[model samples]
Target chain A: MSVRHALLGLLSEGPKYGHQLRQEFEERTGDVWPLNVGQVYTTLQRLERDGLVESDDTASEGTQNVYRITGAGVDELGIWLHTPPDLTSPPRDELVIKVLVALRMPALDVRDVLQVHRRYLVELMQQWTRLKEDEGEFDFALALVVDSELFRLDSVIRWLDAVDGRLKRAEIEPPVAVPELPRLRRRLAVRR
Target chain B: MNVLELREVTKAYGEGMAQVHAIENVSLSVERGALVAIMGPSGSGKSTLLTIAGSLEEPTSGEVFIEGAPLSTMSHNEKARLRRQTLGFVFQDFNLLPGLTAAENVSLPLELDGMKAKKAHTIAMSMLGEFGLGDRASHFPDQLSGGERQRVAIARAVIGNRHLLLADEPSGALDSVNGEAVMRMILNACKQSGVAAVVVTHEAQLASWADRVVFLRDGHVVDQTVPPPTPEQLVHTAQQR
Candidate 1:
């Protein structure tokens, strides 16, 4: 997700100018994520400033200053690739928030709200599937992208089913309220 | 063409006092070259629906069709011949014969359908090779790994250009990674052969590989919808109208 690291990683391949870097990036990712030429150059400049990359003045063509990854850049890329992403904190998911807020409001049928979102997610999944088929027989990069989206949406749909099941059970048998008197009486008996 | 269709099909068991409807008024149609997934919790009639669709079991009342010909119109021999010729089933257990080699197991269905044993074996071996199992062709079922066995089962099911496939939890016994491989093989084979298929699976991830998913609940068709149109479909529809 970090364009900074992506550019640094690309530079590790060898010296590359602005346009070449953009083209290679798109080609490798099956053009699923497009990078702006200006953004690429700006990131390259920042990498040069931070000593992560250096411009090859000798290989420079007209308006095309080639950049190569420094020793430090190789180390940085290595660390980034080996480091595990921080997933301890949950992201701000709109669907989760909506379900929670709906649970508090009795006027809203939470199941109905969940079903609507579930349908939308399924539609998105189908759209991704269609895209994968369109990409043709041997598009590995696109296959990975489609698989990731489909798995994420499938997990969300499973969660909705879980919530629906729990709510249905709660309706059939109202959740029992914990009575405070039993604990107090048990404590007194134990003391006696 | 509709390779398989079930109209208002219902299957109930037992007498009045202990009657249980395994499937109730479930209508489904699968056209050639289509892959439809039937997903539901256990005992929700997923298997029942598949059995009826494949004509392995008859519905208590309702019409079943294969290639637009009503199943009820066929005699017992005719129905049996139809199934042997047009339908193939992949079971959760792999269902390969222990006495036969991988190639023999794959070739058995074709041989039973009256193809020459030598010719059937050759076709089976080639299909196995395509699935990266050519090396295991001579090995018996007990010698093959679980994934290999499942792959062989699939090869057998799709052999002889069978137009329809019914799979009951095809990936059930394999690990997740192997299960995914099996799923991809099924999808690729279906697309390549233009065979219509109905897969009964509890795994949602597997179901996502389907062209459309049909959800069943207590034997009822609770949800059924086709996936968004592919580019080929859009073009085909445009040409039609």
Candidate 2:
């Protein structure tokens, strides 16, 4: 999330050029998030401007500038590692919004809408599972990334199932109404 | 030829007004070397369809066939012999005999069908090795991990020239990692042995391993769709990128 802190942490190990930092960052994160060299260099420049890192141009010939973490950078990385991410406010989720909108629609069956999205999420999870099966066990970094994704998807699925159960218990049904347009009426009739 | 077929099959219980149809006019065919998964919510007749296909229960009406033979024409003993020789089953409970070692549990099916003990044991051992449980072959069901036990159950199901495998929530009792491992084993069995399979599961991610998925709703075949992509295809795409 914070590329600045991530670059600083990598620099804490030793002085490294932009290309080497990008490669190690990808390798450590299981290659899930790819970082371009340009982005790495930009972050380095920002870190130098903020006095968190020092760039030594004389160490390396040509255009390459080797950067190392300053004392301030070590303190920043330490604090970032110990601090927990903010989670007090719920993030805006499109699936949750879709369910809410479907509930208010007079002609739509909310259960059907839920099922459609549920299947899609399941398909996405299956793709990740396939990836995990092929390569996760051989590499610890990839395995951790895959496991984290699977758990995240599993939680969303659980939430969807819980919502479906609540709707069933409440016995809520969409209002029955004939569509004004002929084409819409025909589609609804076919679905029935 | 289709390894399993159900023609206009309907299974009902009770009588008159109280009669309930678990599956009504449902027809399905599973070809050899293909795997089909059935998905549905509770009480949707997924299990009923499986039982009827396996000849474990008689359909109230319509015909069931295995390997082109109608089940209606086979006597009880004949059906039993067919099941012993051609069909295999795995369940959520792992269904291994508590007293038998992994190798013995796997060999029991072959032994019951009149094979010599030595020959059965040899085949079972080879199958266990293929499933990566060679070292655990002498271990009892209780001694093995959940994943290992499920693999043994699967090896037992597919051993001895069995043509079809029917599984009902075979990974239900295991954690996600073990569950995925069980599914991979099942997929491997179907591909390598050319055995047809029908698996009924509540988890759609597990069901996605199948070549086709059938969705059931209130005793009806509501929908059928091919899964998104195969693991091989995904890997190939990733490599290309």
TM-score of 1: 0.84
Chain A TM-scores, candidates in order: 0.84, 0.83
Residue-wise C-alpha lDDT for candidate 1, range B152-200, written one tens digit per residue: 9989888888899999999999986678778778888779889898999
lDDT of 1 at B8: 96
Task: Indicate the fraction of true inter-chain contacts that candidate 1 also forms.
Answer: 0.18
Models 1 onward score TM values of 0.84, 0.85
Q: What TM-score does chain B get in every candidate? A: 0.92, 0.95
Docking class of 2: acceptable
**What iRMS does model 2 reach?**
3.7
* Model 2 segments more than 4 A misplaced: A60-63, A172-192, B230-241
CAPRI verdict (incorrect, acceptable, medium, high) for model 1: acceptable
Clashing pairs for predicted structure model 2, backbone only? none
The best candidate in terms of lDDT: 2
